[model samples]
Target chain A: MKNKKPELVTTAATLEEVERVFEAGADAVTLGHERYALRQPGHFELEQIKEAQQIARKHGGRVYAVMNALMHHDEVGELAGYLEQLAPHVDAVVFGDPSVLMTARQVAPELPLHWNTETTSTNYRTVNFWAGKGASRAILARELSLEAVLEVKRNTRIEIQVQVHGMTCIFHSKRELVSNYVRHQGKDPEQEIRAAQRRMFLKEDNREDQRYPIFEDRHGTHIMSAEDICMLEHLSSFITGGIDALKIEGILKPLEYIQTVVSIYRKAIDRLAENPHADIDSGWLDELKSIQDPARPLGTGFYFKQQIY
Target chain B: MLTQTVQSTIASPTKRKKPELLAPAGNLEKLKFAVLYGADAVYIGGQKFGLRSKAGNFTYEDMKEGVAFAHAHGAKVFVAANIIAHNEDFEGMEEYFRTLYDIGIDAVIIADPAIVEVCKQAAPHLEIHLSTQASTTNWQAVSFWANEGISRVVLAREVSMEEIRQIKKYTDVEIEAFIHGAMCISYSGRCVLSNHMTNRDANRGGCAQSCRWKYDLFEEAEEEDTETPQIGKTELPMFSEEDDSFTMSSKDLCMIEHIPEMIEAGVDSLKIEGRMKTVHYVATVVNTYRKVIDAYCEDPEGFVFKPEWMDEILKAANRPVTTAFYYGSPTEQDQIFGVPPKMAKYDFAGLVLDYDEKTGIATIEQRNHFAVGSEVEFFGPKRDNFIQKVEELWDEEGNSLTEANRAMQKVKMRVTQPVKPYDIMRKEKK
Candidate 1:
């Protein structure tokens, strides 16, 4: 019997990059309209999503629309209309808020639901609970250890997705912190605020080594990890352990970064699926190193070290 | 005489169903004080499976006594077992649920669905209130939880007043929202800054509160830029010396003025969020909010926001207050920016252990230093607050003393007015 390998999921930076990532080797590309999505790589209107869907169909790839914003009343009121328009264009919807689940069930019953409640999707019972509610997959939190991830996969009936490579969100605030800080400094926010600019980072007074990248957008401020998580070496354990999809977060990266990461992870997943006992490939690490930002270090990220404060 | 008048006025129930005043109780003592002070319900952390691992959590024995005390006073006790559980944390969880149910806990505030499953299967009769850690900000999510058999849903602090009203309109499930407490800059349970910075897992229990730590901003160098600015190497410091160092700290939430708005929004419970606070804090906050809630409920049309309530609460408030996310998105003003705690105008002097009305002498257990000449105010749940000067003082041994400086020392002080046991005595700060 042939082994079942987890699908390669990449966040498409643009509608044009959707086909590029699918060509590079992604089974699915996740993107969405910025109004409904939080910290996405790029925004896509319904027409653009339809275009991406056509492109996905040609390459036999799937498209997942991220509608994972913690919905307020206004967003909740407008979600049904957006989902109704978006229903036909995407294969599934990735959501963190349960409001999206209820809305999707009513408006687009056929589309699959991928539960991705950033930090709280820690245990199997919660994942299974969402699975019982018709979620096809659970996106495990980046904070989970490898052992915990396997345990969740072992117990759950639905597909489990884990981030394989890219910047992990360490903090998300609904407040416009940078703009507010600029205003507090008696400067014009339009000129001083680094809205979505990846160049700015925060260094704790006590910790001089680490510089945490920060950005502000319509959803609010998001602090990215100083280290991007590279799970290429651990791809065997996840794919062999029965994780359904591996998500590569392309939120702050360029199209080339996404391409390199997807291809490397894809090759590694294939190699491991073909031979479970294969030796670690130094060449794959070398390819990923080509695009690795020296300033933004890469680590295994909670896979080995317990995240303590 | 004042107690009788206050009691008689509230004896007649309000026409509208007023929201329950819920308070946090870190231990059995805080629980009793919370119940006595006017909290309709008190949420407590047990010895296991709770997020505040450092808090003095209640033992099963403590739970029984606390539950009994609350229930005896017509108040409810809810256990907060709201940790986002890992696989190992599930060990003994079923037994824990059964034990909580056996203890007659009113409900359990839980965030993890898996733990909720274990709880339901083990103790089906145990009521569940979804924790704000789940971040349920919309009506459909509330309804979804309702469909799942949750009795109540504590709306996320990020939720707005208008969103709350809309949620209540759609679902019959009880809505609980925070009216007072420290605000997390990140959405509750969504941050891993502590985890990434330190080895502690914030969701399970240990939160280093790395957000409250001071951080200096640095600009990243462009690609191919060899001269990347190193920490302390740049001539121009990112922030001026006078700028707030605690960049991410939010002003604490105090909704004393918004009692009517909360009640009108159809909130079933107004939660005060400080489980790790002192008994004095629990009493002061609960007492003030209880009076305000009762006043508004008794006469919604004639209800007026009282400045006195704000003044009373400031004695317990550690930080400046803001109506976070309720009025609108909190701006720069809502951030604390390294300011010190607001200086209190008063200090908790003592608790009235026994009051002799005929002799007008009160036996007190001292909390802070107070002298015989100190001007003190006596207040309690039943009676209106009254000020009097301490004319004379004696030790527990009946020896005359000029001052009560020892912590928890029993002192006898002559008072100007009749006092009751459990009455709080506060001295004005000089």
Candidate 2:
């Protein structure tokens, strides 16, 4: 039997964006409430979530609820009810903290779980461990090299997801390090400081060539990569490797940019699905560059280079 | 096997077990010192499959010796194999787990679920304690791991006292928490700054501590400049100039004043971090907490916090201390900017090797410089610290010496008070 094509997944902030990305050839869109999700383009309320699911169904696409927060005790009491309300509306729930699993089992036993512990989802045994706990899929950490990713795929029977494009978060602190720094400067932080607009960057003391984008929200401060990950040229390894999904991180990207990127990946996956050994499409790279932020260059992140000290 | 019967208000109405004092041992010597200093259990890393690769990690022989020593002293030894493993990294882990089990270690602290599975299958008797690197924060996560047969879960440093109390109320699994040590600015195992900037994987024992590195913050100009800004050469105003640079390093966690609160929270283990710290640090921190925990468990109703314990820890602290996330969220005060060298209030003078009570001559091994007339403090695990002035010194060959300056040099001194082996002598900074 021919291998099934991996689902092309991306994030959406609005119902219109959900409709647009699905129209642009994405197979699924992920969104959730501000309280339950970590970094997302925007949070959707319960009503909006149902509407997005409806839109996905109309377009033959899927909806994934981002229940990926490392939950606190105060947040635990609200999870059961949230998952109960969220059960019938989405296809799967992507989570990092296992508390979601415990709560979901009690309130929504039928809801599927996709484990994404951010950076700790490195090896295949752990992937299978989550699969034993009934996770339908596992999102691999972006820090894995291509060789390691293929190895994990070869070893695990569960469906797997990999980020093929866009900004990758390098650091996340539950404390408001940025706001605390603002207060330490003796100035009240302007409301814009907390916004995820790509306006704030960190430069190392002596090394001046790199800029790391940083911002603060309810999940606390997040520092993103100086270069966005663009895996358009390497779509064949994942396609032939029998991976289940290819995710384009659309957390801070504009809707138009996300649509274009999703279209590029969608076409690439289709081409590779038809012909596993295919030449690079020069036009696709050029199209991504035209829409990507000039300040943030695109690189094949951790796919080739070993990130070691 | 090392258990203590103390008190816990949240776990049960009966007299609950007191929390175990867990200390870090980078090597065999540190392990012995930690056990002698009253650690109920000590965690160490082997030369493989662990973080803190820079430290003097134990070999299999060292682990066997260390485990024997700890068990003989009524303490337990735990090996940390907490690296977030990749595929190739799993090569020898099963055999490593079997070897650790054969050595009769109390448990293995692991973060990777795959490795936990390997340990369960290869060495079925070995207990598994989840590493803080897993960042387990809430009770449900604890329950999830418990269902997976994890005996203990180390609560993330981000967890609050109230959260811990609630977690204990709901879950019967043992909970471990960090009470003293440096803290990661990000959620443990949730950061890759080192990998991005320096090509070092922080989750896999190659942490360069990139978070402590200083950075310059800038506000990007609004409105797309037709000119794509050059990476760092732009004319953005540097907001961190006044302090030289911006740093996100957090203050060290210290709970010397909150012993009763921690005990009442039903924490099974109170762990001290810093596997890369010095022997002096292990001794000082372990000795201080040992005294406090003993005092509180002995007289729960009348226990009073001691200022001396805080003073003792300050001698070895590198940065200021904060009760991180215990009371609530940490603020500006909890962060450290413009890195300062490790605080040096006292210098380790020597270690007592042997003492002749009749002759009043103490044999010592010099760690740092100390003169004949230098005043020093002698302290032991079971004895009160006493101050004495060095009147004279002699080399091992019986040659009279004015000072012991050579590192690890054997010196004989006329000590007024009787001192035992493993006793520490430190001098105030001149």
Candidate 3:
């Protein structure tokens, strides 16, 4: 299957757990800070990242170090310089921004660069263009349907990874999910208020999210970017189509989340391997419906004919 | 007059000045290149405090030296502390801002109110360039940022020149627009493709760039491998379709041909998008735009950009240049689905291997796998292009042959006239 897991990422799977998940049919683990901005002075502490890399060694899972929401240009090189310490230990460092890609290329020529979807790579030229800049892979936009993905694949030799399951960017990766958190608490608001204030942009809570301010497109700003993409039905295409990986988004969930998602894809992967193209059992889809992917809003995502099921 | 200058309405900025070509310098070399090439100001980042954290972002020493170099070259430097700052991120770049401001960095692009308030207190004298991440598609948003003492606004790339004219009419803040390069797929630069797959928000400039990934399509409406009939249809079925517009992708932006409209609309500074591009990329693009702009300035009405300029521009390096959003709403015609990457064509013609004025033939290293009878387009400086078919191809030893595939091998070819040291040769794609 083309589904190798587009550079697997997860907070749920540890080095060993991740190895088993991949062995059990997981593809890659995108390492992100579950604590989020709560980590330290930076998006992540270098030592913590180093430890994650060390742990990732056991699984042989390609470690895609997630450092996507940084605003400072300085951090590009700093994080890249930091990644240089990891060397090939970290399989790829996913990042957005043309400028950041340039820095990563100069710093770690051998280490693969995966273009972050935040960089908004939506077409064949972008794929080939970034591929020319040393990008080996991309996290396809969730908004893209299966046909679009195939079109993107045809444009370049770069590997295509799809999100089969996970928490999607609520504002399509733009607005800070926690902006309200910043505004009300900018200098001061109570702890609960502070918690309530977290916004996707402001790092504060977004009151706009509740009332859902109108989006610029004259649409609603009810943040919608990252959504869960579970193709339990099309697991066979995930393999035979040459997808390097099938990613599961949320690592913040309980280990049960990990166990359930990894185990399901594993079974599906096996089934597909045995019978190159087959339908998934209805019961399995029902069981998945019971899981904690409510945040994903239940869509098969873009890789399908993309019906609004 | 001196006293009124400080108090004048037109001069609200305590540090008032006309905005210049604010270019994104992705690396040390590009920093110098941009400054020398014609940029009045350059924006950069060290290890942490800028939006394009992924551009060949400068190192501490690289940034420091770049600042110094630009200052030395009569240019200004702006540090991007533009990312939306969190409580933790505040501490990460707090000291850097103070130090940079104290050391004479021209400005700092900012968005988050928290960051702005912090900078106001921390680096009071530091000028602020509001980033495009703020999504200032309207004058209200511009007015909002302007209220915060923002001196310049990098208006969202999606806004049209007419809208920009309206914004310039309303706001006193200097406006900057991205005149060239790759554009983001989301509205106003707010994307979360990264955080969805990896907890990275694109707006804070930490985008995982999910828009670029290749995907495989299975028609979800059906169970089998059969082609879903409506798969390639571009028209939305309106009321019959789902609630969402079902957009497939975002378009690339380029306003090069529309320089006059942008200038007339009141953009103070023109911006180019590649921060991670190579020097070759910067030089070719910057030089091309520079020529185009000069051409327009020379004759606004009578002058027209020749198709040859656009063709030569294609050779410089590009993603099929399109007039994204500027002309009207972008559609599939602008989209490049399966086009083979256009490259520096005409292969390596004879280098300055030997320029013998006595004989018009310039000995060149044969570039492509060429046979004796292939027609190739030759390119040189100053509107130089011609269809020159290779009537004959002979080896270095003077043996006439059908083709030459050997590496570093030399071949003799005749030209209409003698070629110069910096002249280049290429072939057009059929």
Candidate 4:
């Protein structure tokens, strides 16, 4: 039997970007609120999230709110109230912390929850565990190989999402590295380090050549890969592997970049749906590569070669 | 007069159960010393499926003997099969659980819920303690795991004292918190830095400790150069004058002085953090904490903090100690920034392998240099430390020796008091 094409999921920062993604043929858009999300610049307020939800619904698309932060105790105390206000405004909520799952189940048991704790959901059993715990969809870890994803799909009925583009997060820490560095330099950490203005890079002492970009916010520090993951050529493998959605992880990116990447993936999925054995055209790959930041390189990432650290 | 009477009544000592003093055992020898020195429970890793993969973990035969030895000493042994299992790991898991159950392991510590379910099926008789790698910081999460049949939950180190008190109020599940040891820069153990950088899966057991590595931060230049920028380009250093430092490495955790508060908070276990330490380390740390916990239990109402316990802890600590996230969020001072060298006040001398009461001599395996006349302190599980000059020394072959300096060298030393096999010996640092 021929496999169905996976839905194209993209991220948006603005109301206009939401419309742009819908026009570019995205089936779903992931939006984050300012207080609960890790991304500082792109997060929307409650009213903006409501508008984005309306725009998504008008275009026959869904909006998944990104609340995937490793919340502290006080932060968790604020979750149920926020989730109560947000339950009616969005289609589903994506989260990483287990505490968030329990809180969401308590406040809004009817809401759909997506489990995407970066590196935790690597196998079918983990997916099954989360699915049994009330998560409707589980995003597989980025470190998994194609065969591993297929194995997860073979074992479970829960929907799975895989990242198809954008820079991958290599490290996540609760310690605010940039603020601590500012304090180490004899400056006031609060005054010197502004979350929205912070842009830092770190390189190993031994390997001075490769540098990874780091983002710090109220939540914590997130270090991303030097090269963005571009898996345009591997869409068929993911689609046939029974992946339910293909995610493009650049909510803070430019609107033009979002539209371009979304359009390219939309065409690729359409091509694959028409002909299961068809390969992504070379022209589409070049178009997808053109939207990436010039400073960051592009690679196939762990999709082709497994990282061994 | 009425207010004074009420205050005195509140200050009176009340009976409370002693919290478990749990220590880490990287090997069988460390396990024995930890149990003997004062640990109520010792957590050890088997040959596979544990976080400390580099440690000299116990084999099945060694684990059986270690459990027997710990039980004989009235201490419990919890085996760590706590790695986040992958698809390939599930093949031998049933056999592993069966072996652990057959060997009489008190409980199995796990991080993955799938593994918890596996244990429920494979070894229904065994208890399952949730590892801190689960990052459980709230009461609802604890309640969730408790409903899932988890007997205990190791609260994440980031949880505050107030939060712990509330969690205890909300749930009946046993709560374990880390009282001493190294801290992860990430939340719990959910980090991929080692995996992405070195290809070693931190979740699977091969953590390269990338957080401890020194890194330099730089800001990207705003203006583009006339020359085309290349990928992986080496930019000029932003803050070059500053020393290369471990921006992410945290200070070691020590809560020896806060024993009364922890006990009052209803903590079920106080866990020590090292599984890759020496037998001397296990013995010293366990003994010191045991004394502190016992003293607090004996007089909780009149408890006074002791400075000597801090001094004793410094003898075993290689890094600066901080009460990490216990009071609240850690500040800049709690983190170790610059790559400074560690300072220790004492050096491990040796372990007493056997004692011959007839000759009034103890057979020792030397770890550091100790001469015939040097003053060394001998301490054991049930005995107070007594200083004695090494008046007589002999090799295993019975030849007279003036000094023992070689590593793992067997030597005999005459002592005034009887010594057991796991008794530790140490000398002040020169």
Candidate 5:
């Protein structure tokens, strides 16, 4: 039997980044227009998404539009309309909300759907549920270990996507905690509640030195992992585990970071394609270490040891 | 606004069947109290494969009795088989579902599609209600479940009144919403913080409630030490001041005032959410909602929300109340940040174990401190509450006592009125 290597999935915030990522050899690039996604500092407009789609297609890459925000009832009507507009421009719409997934299935029946239940799809049964409901791909939760991922792969035949790089979100909430904090301090929330701009971190009193970045946007607050996930070393394991796609999580990251990270994964995947049975090159690890953000630490995340609370 | 206008124009309670009042029961005793206190349906967790593992969940034998008790009272009993089952968790689930069905459980509240499939194979006759843990927010999601033969969807807490109206308009699936309960900081109940922090899976039955823990702020050090290039840089303290505030603990939701809005929106059921709560909590909250719902149904046009209902609700609340995301997204005011110690004015006094009509005395299992002269109100199934002074008290040993303080202590107290088993006694607010 021929060994099938997983595709490299990367995220981009703009058409420029999309071009850079495609140049770096990403098979598919995930992007979404502003106000329609959970990402902060999201700048892509409908025109930008269309442009990015055109660039990806030109480079023989695919564009997956993110519709992963937790929707309120009022947004449903607008969302159906937005999905209808964005459908033709993208290959598949990635979603965390069931409502959004079902809405996409209704509004754009031809468009494929990627189910990312935002860490809630902890087991294979949830993936199977979405698969039965018409999800073409299922993004495994960040909390899943490699063993769990293997278990899921063995059970379900649906294409599986795993976050192999960048920040892992630990906490997500609808309440704007940072805005509430500013208001509690007697400051105007409008002026002082620019949490995404500030790039603030939160630490528990007990675990004083550890801090996780708190990202706030129109959708809600997202507290990301203290350390960025680097699974460059585990590329072979994921491929062997039958993962369909290895996703790089940071879309709004610096273009240099995106290019470097995507290129590293691209090289890794290419090397694996050449020699499927060969061990991951130590030089790749060294190269990843050289470009590691001094401010942000790197860890293997829950892929090695599952986070339990 | 349209719902408000329509509700206001209804000169009398609409002839439509009033939505069922659903209550949570942690144990068999609480289940009886929930049905007795005017709950049309009661949801409980079994010994396994359910959320609220800390709750004194029913054994199979207890469930059999509880189900019979509920059915006898014309109320439905739902077994919460709502855990997000992994492959290992499904080992004994099929047998569990068969047992639940054989015992005549009205429905199985489930979240995982695999478990729903298991139930279908094991107990095809049983109805299925999707748990809020499934996070059904939109009509399409509800439609998806409805197509799968799910009779009801406990809408996610993130859903709003406007959305409920829209969902009802679009889908035939019955909507059951949390009308009163502790709120989760995460969307729906799909949180992993508890599991990540404490190793207790929140999706499975164990939740350590890590969100309620206090957190301090810290910033990552921007500059690296050039002299010690190999050494890791330490994170810097973001704030010099110390503050003890719970940034994640949300206020308990209270929707007593919004009963009209819910009814007008065509919600199918109003669910009260504390399964691990005491029987007194169940009785007080269930009774208060029962009165409010009845009042609204009696005269929709003449239905004026009484301020006294809020006062009645406070007697059962442990935390400050917020309307949650019902009106809109909750503001800073909606959350309780600082840990303000709260005490309900009325304390759960005791539960009547038995009453001797000849002696005019009741055998009570004391829950809180109560003295001989303390004025207590006794309430029970289909009976109006009556106040009486505890003139005499006797321990199980027949020794006279002036007061009862120890929890679960059996004490005989003189009563002026007849009290039945399961009747709850409470000390009045001074």
Candidate 6:
């Protein structure tokens, strides 16, 4: 518990967006590809990250490095060393790989790191399990509504970070389509044709369809792209609730998605500056639905134990 | 017994008792057509829980009435309520189970283990067929479910036939193999790509099928720049780094020639996977296999498969047919999932218009070409009664017609004798 502070952390892959999130009132910025990978190798080298850290520090915002993707052990060790060199400038590192966390602890024992949600840190047992692994905080599953989140936080010592607003991932874990993309491309004539049989998918400028679906058979590709996740209406209640970190997810969403989402969420958060009320003003819900969400359906999330309807 | 039905009918010719020709019936008309064409037992989904969401899934009212209708004709109906459920979704199941129980539907095919537990609690008398979504790939998995009181288990298509024999040995569970239909790229229908890429979960029946979509990636080229630089003697790409990688997709599943081998594996039931498909696909594919399975059953020793039947199987709107993982072991070469042939020889337009009892007249509405010389198969009532011969054809005006070619072509037909309503009329494609 970094002094038991309520840190409004917004995750982003780009520095410019991180700056925008801070301007919108983020307490800290967690960097990694939140479904958006960094295009340049290692995404950005240590020097580039150091520059981003300086920008974040200027606004009194902390920088948290995120290594969410599946990484090789050696590469993780190398990054751990690089991260150690950047330790004096950065805050905690959000991590999942056992090796990466071990190396981070070995290299810079003082740096704080939260266990990434890839570890499926849901129950108190799991949260405490990761805590034993040296994780100070745990990101709760997006599908667990408000009440569920509070239950876990109450039971576990690790602080809770809930996805406040962003794209909801139904493909939570397991890498089938991506693996197919990486493995089956180029050579086989059969695979080339099947890819053509698939439907089209566009997420933040990334589009591909293997005519044949990567998962379920011939009924085309079974997929659902719902709207973005927006919790504006439920914010006051969530803040009053046990959530420690309010997260806005979109490293790959457009600049407009990043900016508008940050601004709206910022206003909603500020609305609760005095007493946190549970009432969700209808206008906030409307504004959220009006936004262009390329992801699947948006949910108020299973956060509130109280299903208002 | 039923001699006039066997040799003169069916695909190849079976040496032993013919495997039941299980066919799909999405609607009442298709159900009638299926039974008349010698379907041993028919499988369908009532509106609630079946694999094919787009199917004319059965409603409660439809199931109650449909079950009675199927039973009147001396056939069986297995209702599908295979939707996967989470804890919160288990509220109204008591009534759902009782409703299915009262309807007299032969059995309910279930997917989720939770739902199976629910069914056991709610409807103790009801029989259960475990849906393919259970992904029973091993003998242990099959026997485990069987111990839980599953009457039949639809084996995952990925399992090899060798495993089937092994599974059969360990458990008394009736194994149902998908004799034909679409292929799943993910292992055992549990891909989150649907829920992840889209909020649709394939396991829960609301799969938006995200795997079928095409995505482009930059493939790391073979000739890495000598500068494919080792930053710290590591080969992995750095995070946040962009690389141009390419992607590919998987193909559909089809197995027509390997029926003999699959039958040899001791499957109690053979399943065909096209609930969302049209009636024409059902009739054509069912009739083709019906003939082949019968041939194999008739002459266990003296049977040679006719090559023309393979050509007949391809006439369906199919992707490239692979034997699937049915042989001793599936080789990499056995995996054939490419683009489907752009053209189909048959469109399976519509059902036979009607049938005359005395004159044995069956009317046909053509979805494809039916020539005087071209053989049209009459899949008649009960197993082993489907007939293949184009001795004659009559037009709508009752004039004996030679050829009827167009979309929705109707013709009056005079069969040898005794044709009943609900008999399917399909012409062999090749």
Query: Which candidate number has the best lDDT?
Result: 2
For lDDT, candidate 1 versus 3, the one ahead is: 1
Query: Any runs in candidate 2 off by more than 4 Å, and if so which?
Result: A1-3, A190-198, B1-17, B224-235, B238-240, B339-342
Q: Considering just chain B, what TM-score does every model have?
A: 0.92, 0.93, 0.69, 0.89, 0.87, 0.76
Cα misplacement distance, residue A231 of candidate 4 (Å): 0.4
Q: Which candidate model has the greater lDDT, 3 or 5?
A: 5
Per-residue C-alpha lDDT of model 2 across residues B181-222, encoded as one tens digit per residue:
999999999999989888899999999889989888887764
lDDT of 2: 0.88
- Could you give candidate 5's per-residue lDDT for residues A1-309 as a string of tens digits? 345878899887667788988998899988776566776335678888889889988999899888887666667678888888989998999987767877787889999999886667667876887898888889888777788888988889799999989887777787887777657656676764443343567776676545567757777777777677898877887777778999998643567777878888888887776666777778877877776655567887777784432
DockQ for each numbered candidate: 0.62, 0.64, 0.04, 0.56, 0.46, 0.06
> Cα deviation in Å at residue B32, candidate 1?
1.0
Best-first order by DockQ: 2, 1, 4, 5, 6, 3
Docking class of 5: acceptable
TM-score, cand. 4 vs. native: 0.93
Let me know the TM-score candidate 3 reaches against the reference structure: 0.48
> Which lDDT tens digits does candidate 1 get at residues A118-178?
8888888889889999899999998899999999999999999999888888999898887
Model 3 alpha-carbon miss at residue A44, Å: 43
Residue lDDT tens for model 4, A170-225: 77776677777767777776664453243567887886766677777676778877
Ranking by TM-score: 2, 1, 4, 5, 6, 3
To one decimal, what is the Cα RMSD in angstroms of model 4 from the true structure?
4.3
**Model 6 chain B — which ten-residue stretch has the worst lDDT?**
B230-239
TM-score of chain A of each: 0.96, 0.96, 0.73, 0.92, 0.93, 0.75
Residue pairs with backbone atoms closer than 3 Å in model 5 (clashes): A308-B195, A308-B199, A309-B195, A309-B196, A309-B197, A309-B198, A309-B199, A309-B200, B13-B300
What DockQ does candidate 1 score? 0.62
| Residue A167 lDDT (model 2) | 84
TM-scores for candidates 1 onward, in order: 0.95, 0.95, 0.48, 0.93, 0.91, 0.56
